[model samples]
Each structure stands twice: as structure tokens, then as C-alpha cells.
Target chain A: MNWHEAPDMRNWILLLLLLLEIATFTFLSGVRFDSAGDFTAYFQSYLGDLITQSTPTLLLAFGMTLVLITAGIDLSVGSMVALVGCIMASFPGNTEFWWTAVPLGLLTGLTLGFLNGALVAWLDVPPIITTLGTMIFYRGLCFVVMGDLEKAPFITVPGYEWLGIFSGVIVMLGLLYLIGGPYVYHSRWLRELFMMGGNRIAARYAGIPVQRRTLQVYTLIGFLGFLAALSFTARNSSISAGSLQGFELQVIVAVVLGGTRVQGGSGTLLGAFLGVMLIAVLEEGLRGASIWGDTYLPFEISHLEYIFLGALLLIGVWVSNIAHQRSRA
Target chain B: MIHGRLDYRHRRRIYFLLAGNLLLLGLIRVLLKEGSSFAEVLRRAGPDVAPVILAGLAMTSVIFVGAIDLSVASIIAVAGSAFGVLVHHDQPPWICYFACLAAAWVLSMWNGYLIRTLKIPAIIVTLAGLPFYRGLALIVADLGIPDFGGNISVYDAAYHQPGKFYAGWILLATIIAALIWEAFGRTPRQWLARGNSEEACRLLGMKPERILQSAFCAAGIFLGFAALIAVTRLQAIEPGRMLVGFELHIVGAVVLGGTNIFGGEGSFGGTILGAFFLYFISQALTYAGASAYFQEAITGAVILAVIGLDCAIHRRQKQLDELA
Candidate 1:
């Protein structure tokens, strides 16, 4: 669980892959730079926008890393965020959002997370099954709350737009990943999570509070879900029952790509960060190069994203496994 | 039933599902309008339940060998895309059906191959395949059709025969075949053995990997029929959007039917009943005049409640075994 435990080989490889993607897509997108400064400016603004747009995913990836470390997954995350956003949207876009809607949304997320934890930890329902069930149930609740309505009241909320901006998000990520991440990385708390994930029964028999740890990890994800919902709603300035569909998989993929084992017992927040960026870059690159794809490819360029993302996940996991085996040898 | 192969839990699940189905039917009958016959319920049951039951059966076989496929819905989309492309080309209906079946079979076999070759878990392989196959479907449709939009429309009645007309017959035949296979086949027993313990299976001279692969092959065949039925029933083949959330429903049905999620024990009869029970639960919601939005919530709650209760009931036994 050391920050330097896995070394930096995978990160360097991912960084190179990200650079290659940007280079290819930039050429494909026909970005014409008048000067060196112009190119730098263009890239700066592009990166800024990409980070701003993908803040929710990045935040969730932090939480997902911890969950994976515990050998549990919260597939209900997307639905949880959507439901929270929908709940927030039900209120007016005034200062009341601060005192009423936002806190309520956070509580809803905590309650939902606690319920998921109870099912998995207390009732002994498998994490996957519990989350799958909750994924549907939470989504169903979203539909009931919003009922085919798309709410956009966040635009009127004072200072809410800050959450969507580069500077604001940078501060948040700096705190979460830099300050909070390192704290958790070095803590006995996280080591205990690793222990539980590596072997739950062994940890339990050793007097680790297994049930409490499971509950805490899930509840922490819930708090992260609240932050994610805030970031998502502020940026999109809208809410709907179906918003953020397929988002859980995106977060899971990014974390997994970061070399987080699905079997758990180990993960790094830094890896999750890099994984999120790699995917965010690909997403933006595909969008920018859509015209190129239209000309050179038979399918819609958007469809290629799915293909690339899927291929990237498989390749990432396969290569990681190979590296893992080689290191073992 | 079916000799001693069917266990106590399997029988209990079958009974539970059957009772639920009948209870829903009775409620619907009692609440029916004067003119509407219970016959309407029977008539609509086959096509409605066919795909889910088939998918459940497919999943049951895989889960029997301690693996799962989260890629079934995506695979269905691929099969549907193939069917749509063939129909667009004015291929014979039978040819289109055969091609659809082949697409499912090949992809499922490919799933087996990937899991075997990579030594990665089936869940991870299929999780990747989920989006990969959907993208493959979209790419296939985009490449095959001229002036392709988001969806390919197939309005020909001839092409809809399997999904619309013959779904019942197909369901009956497949159910019968699967039940018989579960009862007496060496393959099913082998799957159970592998699921129960891979090392023990190897010690007994059986190859666990090969047995697992054969289960996938059997699942592929069942999924082929499921895909055929699912695709033909749709008037428009929207590969990207078609059959979204189908894998969950199939998983739900299989688990409800008393199949262990961790594998090693189950019954095809239970799966058939599980699918019917789910279908009837939703149908009852419609009849009870519940809001459409509430239906999904109710379905999710029902699934959670059923599974949660079952797990809760067995918690003490599991704890005791751990202590032992």
C-alpha cells in the first residue's frame, strides 16, 4: 500500500500512451498552430477544459480506488449521483440550495451508501449483487423523483459554477489527491482495508473490525458521491432521471486501468488519477477528431470511443497481469 | 423430481417461483375486466418470457461452472446487428436467423477462448466484452449498411417469425432439452464438479478448464436461440441501445431460480419458473394500475428483497461452516 510500492513503470507507460493519443488526434483534428506560443495556449486551454469536464469522474475514481482496495465495488454510484442531482434539482435555484438542497443531497447519499454497506456487510449479500440490486433500485427511485422532467435550476445558484471551473476543481483535486490521498495512503486505516480485501475472514479472525470497515468504506464512497454529484450538476447545469447512465463503468474502468486489481487488496490513488486522465484525454481526442473519422472511417467517430475504451481496458488489465506475473517470477 | 440430482434448495426455489407466478395470475384474473380472458395472459406469456428464460438458462450453465457472463446483453446487440444487416441485404429469413445464431455462438465461444487464454477471470473478460461487443455491433451495422442511421429498421413480417410466432415453441423445446440435459447429461455433472472444486475435479481426472469451456459452448447455443428470439421481436435494430440492462434481468432470474451465484448447483426448471415469476410480477403491476415509473422501482425492490431474504436465512449456516 506504499505510494511507491508498485514503482512508476505503469504510470510512465500510461503517460506515453496519453501523449501519443493527443498527438495523433491533434494531427487528425487538423490543429493548425500559427506559432509555438499559440500551440502552447491551445493545449493549455484544451487540457483545462478536459479536466473541468471530467472532474466528476476523477473524484469518483478516488473513491473507487479505495472501494476496490477493499475488494468491494459500488456499481450504484451512477444512480446514486443521478438521484442526488435529481433531488437537488427539485428545489429552487436560490440561496436555499446551500442550506436545504445540498445538505439533503449529501444525507441521501450517505443513507444510500449505508444501506448498501448494511446489505453487503451485515446481511452477507455479496458486494456485486448488493450493488447491482441497488443500482437498479436507485435508478428506479430517480425516475420516480424526476418523472421525465429535466431540471436546470443550478444555473441560478450563486457560486455553484465555481465547482465546474479549472481553478476551483484544481484546488479540490489538490486537496483530495495530494493532501487527503497521501494521508490515506500512509494510514493504518488503509492497510486494514488491504488486509480485509486480501482475506476478509482472516482479517476478521485477527480482530479487525471487518463489518465496520466495510461500512466505513462504502459510506466514504457515499460522501465522495455527494461531491461528484455537486461537480456533475454544476458543470452540466442540468438534471434528469437518466443522467450519467453508464458512468459507473467509466469510473470502474479508469480505476482498473490504473492497475487496481478487481480482486482488491491493493490500489494507488495516483494510478487512479493517471487512469482518469488517460481516458479523459481519449474521450476529448475522439470528440476533436470526429471530423477526421467521418472522412476516414465508415462508422461514426463516437462509436470508435467505445471500441477504443474497451480495447484499452482489456489491454491494460492483460498487460498489468503479465507485468505482475513477471515480477512474481 | 429428475431423480436425486435436484437438491432441496433447488426444489424450494422452483416452488417459490411457481407460487409467485400463480398468485400473480390469480390476482390478474380476479381483477380482470369482464371481457378480457385469462387466455390473453397465456397468449402473451411466451414471447414475453422466452428471451429472459433462454438467457437465464444460458447463464445457469456458466454459473454452474463458477463463472458468469455480463456480456450477454452486448452479445445480443451484436447478434441483433447481424440480423439487421442481413435483413437489410434482403437475405433469406432462415439465413438471417442462422447468421444471428452464429454471431452469438461465435462470440460466446470467443469469450471462453479469451478467459482460457488470458488466465483472467470470466467477470473481467465479460465486463470488457460488454462495451467491446456493443461497439463491435455498432461498427458492424455502420460498415454493412448503406446510409446507416442510428438504427436499422426491419419491418418485414417474414423475418419476425421466430420472435413473434415461434417464440413459444422455441422456449418449450429449449426448456425441455435443458431440463433433460441437467437431469442426465455428463456435461452438466462435470460442470458441477468443476464448480464445486477445480482441484478436486483435476484430481478425479477431469480437466476443469475444458469443462468450463464446454459449459460456455452449451451457454452459447442457448444464447443463440435467445438472441434469435430477442432480435426478431424488435421492429428496429438499434445495436447501441438494444437490450440494455438485459444481463441484469437474466442474472436476476437465474439467481432467483435457486442457482448459486457462486455456482455448483441449480436447475433449469427453477430458471424457467424464475423468469415467469418476474414477468408476472411486472404484469401484475400493470394490472394493479401502478404508475409506470413505480414498476421499475418495485421490480428492483422485489429482486433485492428476494435475494436478501434468502441470504439472510442462510447466514447462520454459513457462519457455522466458517467456524467449523
Candidate 2:
């Protein structure tokens, strides 16, 4: 059975999302026509900030896509980010601290992720319950470590500034694309995650190392969380326990929107990337528009965005089900 | 011979459940402080926690069927907001109460339909509903009524009586409904079946979709009543922040009460006691001067501990059964 026969509707969704975003941007930018230069400048700055702001979520989503494909979730990623960010921002004043801090953050993330893997894979705990418990535990630990205080700028080293902006995001994305893109698309071990998600018992009976793969996937998410935290803190120039609060939800939404089934198996990283971009751009477009732009939609911008997201998520699943049914028929 | 064996097994299960409840209560008592009046602590914790226990039970019913409703808190918010809005208009208290309940039920049914028709997982559907319903509550609150500015106080006799006394009656009614369900209902049976193995249940002539829909509907009614209790207790509703993080507490209570997270096996008695135990623990911990942060951490740990213990017990029971 060629699984690739499934209709690649992710491209269409991405196209539609992007078109809507561009239209919103165009219309909203038109509102300030009297000051064209100011509008253009503000738009550029806004776009820059949006890209930088979205980088961390994008990174997290990239790793999350793999985990979801394996039919597991990494709730501790958000806490991992906060913890790593705290560590990065709490580096000693010495210039040599970057070497220690970066490696230490990554190590911490890996260890935590591995622990999650161990609990679920080795101890036979259910993934949802295990991650749910760790989600709170890790967050509480971060609070304890940081003493509930926000960490100040500690990464003021000469070469560190490059990790915070457009250039940094591009480099990081490129590295991930190089390493992960092929590993998922070409490698056999990696492809087993898809098969495992499709049917765990079948995969296990086929001699797949389900437990080991689960461990590896969670560990990857932890490392990505570390990278994301490093970049996020550098961009923001500070760290706090609340730095990445509720981010796991955003990652899940992106992964699902990008055509990754929440039930696991059958997804692409590119789709996840587009999903993150779509949400970020939608928010940016709404903010550009003068229509209740001051308040974040659900809480502040505009409640319409959430409604739109909910509708899109429902529609995506419905369409996918229809497609599956039709293909079977 | 079969009847005797079944009776023996049933008695054993009851004994086991009772022993678990007693252990939990004893743990709470010890944790609170020895030599203090345990009866007094229970009495004080009872009324203070009556509403949460009611709401948690409603949530647990849905969870037992292997579905979750994250929108319970949102329902509470909207119900409270609607009640406040009606009272602000000088509407009769009875009308406001019924309206709030009706609104919650309709919203909950919408959740049920979304999950049923769309085939979306409960977690995703309800996560989306959480914010969506909260937004509705906010909008309703924003549109202030004629007499009152933006807030509705429950100082009036009509509201206070329901909030204080009748709300407990609603909880008692829920317990009765659950008992009736356990005793003579195909709905609960189907739910358990679906939770265990949907495919197998389907092969066995059970319509999983219909059973799930009915389960959600029942859960919706319970949630509606829970929302009423919340509104009456709060007297005023700020839909924006009402019952934030309340779903966690409900799930924690359900799991602590001995319900399997994977679904299929649990008892209402265990869950009711679980709710009481959780409330008592929180009160006792607070009384012992634990900070809010520590309380949250401890609560999370307790949930993990309970689930872990349940898993261990379940595994051992399975092993014993297999040997037999």
C-alpha cells in the first residue's frame, strides 16, 4: 500500500492560509495610506518582530511533529524551553560562560526528555498521563530554580547576539532542515515512527523497537526545546518562568493544522512549518488591521482569530476523513 | 456455583473500594494534624468544597467514558456571566437560573455534536471550546444590562438560597443519577465498552457513536447543574477568569478517586470520595500554611501518586486473575 497516495491537502491549506494573511496585510496597510512611508516602515519592523517572535514556536513545532508522528507527545517541551532560557540568561559574567551555558542547557533538555522517554517506554506509563505529570513537575522545577524571579541578560558575549535575529533563525532552520528533513524523509529507522503510529501492535509484531524509538523522539524534542530556549532568550534578552507558558498547545495546533493527525502517524515537517507561519501571520495581519487590533483576539487581539482557528481545525479533520473515505471507496 | 462466585467477587470489589476510601481519609487526617478534631475538619471542608465536588463528579462521568470536557470551566464562566446579566436586568431569579442552565446545556451539546460528527478527539475539540466559550462569556459580560452596570451580585434571597442549599441538592441528585446509571442503564455499559475497545464494541452490535453522544449529553446536563452551583456561589461572575485551571482540579479528583485514566473501570463512590479527599487535603494543607505554589505542586504530586498506585494495584490484580 502506497501511503503517499493520500491527497497532499497540506499544500492547499498552506496556500489558502498565506493568501488570507497577505490580503489582511494589504488591506490593513492601506488603512494608514496618509503616511505611506511610516506605514511601510512600521510594516517592515512588524514583520521582522513577528518572524523573530515565531521562531521559537516554529522550532518547537518542528520537533513536535516528529514526536506526534511517533504517536507520543512532549508536554515538557515548554518547561524545557523555560528552564533552558533561564539557564542561558543566568550565565556568569565570564565570557567563557557561553560554552558552558549552551551545552548545559542542551544537556538539561536531553536529560529531561530522556526521563520522559524512560517513564513512558520502560516503566509502561501511558504517554498522556506521564507527560501531563511531567509538564507540571518540570514547570514547578523551573520556578524553583529561578526562585520565581526573571533572569537578567547574561549572554552579552560578543558572538552571542547573532543567535537572536533573522540571521539566527535562518541558520537554525537550515541546520534542522539539513539534519531532520532527510532523517525523516529518507531514513528507515525514522520512518518506523510513521508505521508505529499507524498501528503500534503491528509495528511491534514486525520487530520494530518501539520503546527505543519513543525514547529517541522525546530526546530530540528536548534538544529542540533547548535550542528554542537559547534563541528565545537571546531575542528577548531575559528569561522567566512564564516565558513559554501554554506553548505546547500552540505546537499541537500547528502540527494538527499542518495535516498531522493528532492520533499519530502520517505527517510532514514542511506542513508544520507552514502551520506555524499561518498562525503567526494571521495574528500579525489582524494586528495590522485597525479593527479591534489593540486587544489580542481571544484575550486581547480579536476573538475572531480563535473562531477561525477552531473552524479551520474542524474543517481540516472533516476534509481529511472525507478524503480517506473516498479513497477507500 | 457461578452465582456464588460472582457474589464473592462483587463483595471483594466493594471491600477493596471501601478500604481505599478509608486509607485516603486517614492520609488526609494525618496530613492535617493528629489530635485535631478530624470531624471538625471534615465539617468545615464539606460546605467549602461542595461545589467543586459536584463539578468534579460531572467531569468524572464524561472522563469514565474515555472522553474529557475541558469546557466545564468555560460553562461555569458563561453560566455565571449569564446569571449575572439576567439579575442585572431585574429578571426573576428562577428565570435567570433556568436560563443559565439551559445555556450551559446547549453549549455542552454543541461540544458533544462537534466531537461526535467531526470525530475529533475530545482533547482537541474541548481545548478549542475552552477559549471559544470563554470568549462568548466575555462578550456577554461586555454587554451590560439595564439596572446593573456590569456585575450581578447574588445578595438577593433567590440567588443565595440556590447558591447555598439547593446547589447541594443538585450534587445529591447527580449522585443518584450516577447510581441509577450504574444499576440499570445500557448507556453506562456502552460507555465502558467503547472505552475498552471501540472496534470490538462495534463488532458486538453496539453503536459506539450513539453511546458516546448519549454519554456527552448526560455529562452536559451534569455540567449545566455544576455551572448553576458555581454562579450561585460566586454571586458575581467575571467570565474572563472564572474557573480557570478548574479542569485540572476535576481531572485530578477523578484520577485520585480511582478512575482509570485509560477508561473502562471506575466507581462513582470512589470518585465522590476522591473529590472529598482532594478538597480536604487542600484545606488541610492550606490550614497548615503551605504556600499557593507549594499547594499546586503537592496537588500535582498527589495526582501522580494516586495514578501510580492505581496502576500498580491494577497490574497486580491482572496478574492474580491470569494465574487463577
Candidate 3:
């Protein structure tokens, strides 16, 4: 068979690339294994750190995949998450925050998301424009609520710290990816989203209630944003107005790089998982590879993330387009 | 019938902007204090607003052709980096300015080139360019300056002249030229044709790719001027932090000007008005003594309100057309 007709080649390539990246960066960072146990210990800790750091991104990526599959985007994801954190930070650090701040954060997230959905669904504004406007709008609201202050009520909150740790976050990710992923993958809703992304007017003609679905998809993103805020604030123990700046792009890039379509119609939860891992690994590797960068590179090692991100997005899109063409052919 | 082709919505948007700007000026005049200078405020508005209008015009061209360029802010940052690098090396002021213009122009055309050759969506190509160029800017800055601080300071009077003195003139010159060309130019009309329907344009033997390329080329020139002014206006050039959220501001202005986000419609004149209208809103907020933090929020709220209203008003018509 022609290479273009190969089944699921990109995923395999990504897996190989992930391993290659780990090996290269591990070498560059000069990690030595004292024993087999030492190696296992290091990898375990590294894997845990990666999960804790990427919990928010992975959660939001699932929502973003669903949104893109419905032919929409949520550029306001970063701002939405930041706003929730900022709102929650305003409450006292006592147990009351769990009841008051957490619920308020949830309400704010849903309301903000519903606003985006209503604008796109009822008012007929484009998703990009609506979210772009709300991105700035919500960020501005964050500043308004928090001012120039940085708040860390989560640090004092009882039992909230576990959300940032390996075991707690791992369980959450396991439930989301393992259980929810398969259900969504097989559900009728996913098929409807695929149709809507493929052709909105046709889906409406097919009685998919395009408007309601659009509303639901965006509102669901709001709930995800709240969850992301929960994990982020718990892990960091602080919140600021401008936290998670450019985060939406990161998630979008990861999801898109994972084989999700930018123009919508088709995406995979598995691809999103791999894509986020690919980026997360690259970021972690680069952070460790600063020793090499200090001698050989003039710019900060972290800056390379943006360059790699762009390249990876392009490569993924190329893979996707080839697959798109093969299907058409 | 000078605007004979403008639909009712676009026309109302123009009128609304005109009245809005005038009302804002009036409010500013009222809010003027005894010690403060209203005339100075009016004078500052020209140069202050030039970069935005130029960028808006650039956005207008690409958006007119049904494509969006989300990377122009990063392109400008790269231009600023080039300008800073040249200045740091003791290059002539002219060389620095020219490099700034050329850098932005080249990157923008490169975007068009990629989209044309690769057949990727313009949004994706530019969106990729967003961070890609930002990293490029930082690397270039890191490479150029010996002791690369985060920002490069230009202190010379000569270097600052373009942004400080000639911004208004440059703005006027570009606006006049762009509006005239837009009114009488076959090329821009071809862009509109392609934007409306690529397949139709291809069937008619007009190269949609070439037209799309032209839109980017035109956008590049406008963006070049915008970058030059914006970079020079700043005493310290920080490519990393400069124009962080500027892309959305340009999009807001373009959409407010009645350009369809998906393209196939809009005007330079409308974009100018929309840019001015947004500027005036912030100015009005300032004159009303709103907090600095509140201005961004209010500006966002205002954009949402206007766009929301415009879309709502046209929703019925859109639904009717879909049914038709």
C-alpha cells in the first residue's frame, strides 16, 4: 500500500518521536543511572511531575477536542481558568472557601462559558471572534477582581493540596481519559459533533439542534475551565490576574498537533493525549537540557518551546491533511 | 452612491462610528481641566492612533480576502528586534528603519507563500507563525546584542523621529494611498472575488492563490509601517512583551468596521473609522476618570456589545438566507 494509505502512522511516529525526545534530552542533560532502581526512581518521579504539571492542560484538551469537533473554539480557556482562580482566591483560606469560593468559581466558569455559548449560538457571532473578545474581557475581569494582588487562599484551604500531587491527579486523569474517553469515543453525541463539524447547516438539517449543541459544548468547556483552575491553584498555591497567559494556545497547539483538525469534523481523544504528552515531554526535556543550552545556545532553552511547538503543529497538520486527502480520494 | 455596494449593516456601522468619535471628542472637551490641554490631547491622538490604524488596515486587507493573520503582532516584534539589533551595531538610522520595514514585510509574505504552496488554511499558517516568529525575534535579539538585555534602548533623537514626529504624516499618506487604490484598483477587486468564492474565481480563470498572496503582500506593507512606528515609539524595545494581546485589538477593530471575520467584505475607510472609534472609547473612559485596569475590561465589553448587537440584528436575515 502507498504510504499515504497507511493506517494510524502519525500516532506511531509520535510515539517514536516522544521516545527519541526523551533519549536526546536525557543524554543532553547528562543523567547517570547508579543502578536499575535509581533509573526507575528517576523515571517515576519525572512521570509524576509531568502529570501534576499537565493536569490542567490534559483536562482542557478533552474539552477543546469536543469543541473543535463541533466546529468551534474556545480561545477564552486561559482567561476562563484564570478568572475562576482569581475569583476563588478572593475568599478566605478557611473551610468556608470550599463551600463558597469553589462553588462561586464553578458558577463564574459556567456563566462565562454560557455567555460565550449564547453569543455564538443565539446571536450568531463567530466562535473565534466571540472567544477572542471574551478572552480579553475575562482577563480584564480577572484584573478587576484581583487587582494587582497575588492571592494564595488555596494554600491554607484544608485538604486541597492533594489535587496537585501524583496520586490524586493521576486518579482524576485516569477517570477522564480511561472511562470518559471510551464513552465519548463511542457515544452518539460524538457522531453528532462529527457531523456538525463536517457541515453545520447539514447537521441542522439533520435535526441535530446545532444551536443547543453549540451551547452545551461551550458550557462544558467552562466546567473544564473551572476544573483546570482547581488543579492549577491547588498545585501552585497562588493565583494572579494574568496566570495561564497564552495557555489556550498551548492546549490548542497540543490538541491540533495530536491529530485533531483545526477546521473541525474529526479528532481523537487518544491523539489529544499523545499530543499533550509530546509537548509536555518536550517542555520537561528542555527544562532539564538548560545545561546544554547555557554553553551552546544564546537564547534561553525555554524559548525553544515556542519554535518546537510551531514546527510540531505544522507537521501534525501536514499529517492530518494527507489523511484528509486520502479519505477524499 | 460612492459606497453603493455597502450593505445596510456596514453603512450603519460607519455612521455609528462617526457619531461615536464626535461624541467622544465632545466628552473629552468637557472633561478637560484648567491645567490640562485638550489641544495637546487631540495632537497626541494622531501619532498614538497611527500604529493601530495601520495595523487595522493590514488586518482589513487579509480579512477582506477571507483570511486572518494572527501573527502580525509577533511579526512586529521581530521587526522591532531587527531594528534594535541594527541600532545596537551602530548602523545608520535609515538602515535600521528599512530593516524593520523589510523584516515585517518579508515574514508576512512568507506566511502567504506558505499558505499558497502548502494549501494550509491562512489561520493555521499565521497561528503557527505567531509563536514561531516570537521565538525567532528573541533568538535574533539574543544573537545581535552583545549583552542581550530583555529590552534594547534607543536614545538618539534621529532614531525616534519616525515614531515621534512623522507618525501622523505616514498615517495620512498610507490611508490616502490605500483608500484610493481600494476604490479604483482591479487587484483589490480580484481579492474580493477570490474571498467570496475561491472555486468561482478559479473557474473564471483568476488565480485565487495569487489573489490571496496579493492580500498578504498588501497587508505586509501596512504592517511594516505599523511596526516601524510602534517600535520607534517605545524608548525601550522589548520584543517579548510588546504588543502581547495586540492581535485581538486589531481583530476587534476590523470586525467593528464591518469586515466579516470569514472575509469577502470590508473597506479601508471603515477600518480607519473602527480603529478610531475604539481609540475614542478608551479616551472617553480616560476622560471619565475610570481606573486604568477598567479600561481594558470596558473596551472588551464594548466590542462584545457592538458585535453582539450587530450579529443579533442580522440573525433573522442570516436565517432567512439559509432557508432561501
What local lDDT does model 1 show for residue A272?
A: 93
For model 1, the superposed segments whose C-alpha errors exceed 4 Å read A1-5, B1-3
Q: Model 3, range B173-281, lDDT digits (tens) per residue?
A: 9999998898888887787777789999999998899899999999999999999999999889998889987887899888888888888877788889888888888
**DockQ, per-model, please?**
0.72, 0.30, 0.73
Candidate 2: residue A109 Cα off by (Å):
1.8
Predicted candidate 1 versus true structure: per-residue lDDT over B229-272, tens digit per residue:
99999899999998887897788778778888888888778888
Q: What would the per-residue lDDT of candidate 1 be over residues A1-329, giving only the tens digit for each residue? A: 42233647678778888889888988988899999999999999998998899888998999899889889988889999999999989999998889999999999989988999999999999888888888888999999999999999999999999987888889888889889998998999999999998998999998999999999989888888888899889889999999988888899999998989999887788889889998888888888998889898878888888888888888889988887777766
Give me the candidate number with maximum TM-score: 3
Instruction: Please report, as a residue range, the 10-residue window in candidate 1 chain A with the lowest summed lDDT.
Output: A1-10
Query: Could you tell me which residue pairs clash in candidate 3?
Result: none
Interface RMSD of 3: 1.3
The C-alpha stretches of model 2 lying farther than 4 A from their native spots are A1-9, A29-46, A86-103, A146-162, A237-243, A292-301, B1-40, B144-169, B198-207, B287-289, B309-324
- lDDT (10s digit) by residue, model 2, range A1-329: 43324435546657676777777676754555568798788768776777788888888888888888877777667777887777666676457767888788889889878878887776656677767767766776676567667776655666676788888877897788767687667989767999988887678778999889989888888888888887887787778876776677778777777877777877888888888878887766755564544432223344456556666666766776666656777
lDDT of 2 by residue, B199-266 (tens): 89889998877877777777777777777777887756677767765776676676666566667656
TM-score for each prediction? Answer: 0.97, 0.85, 0.97
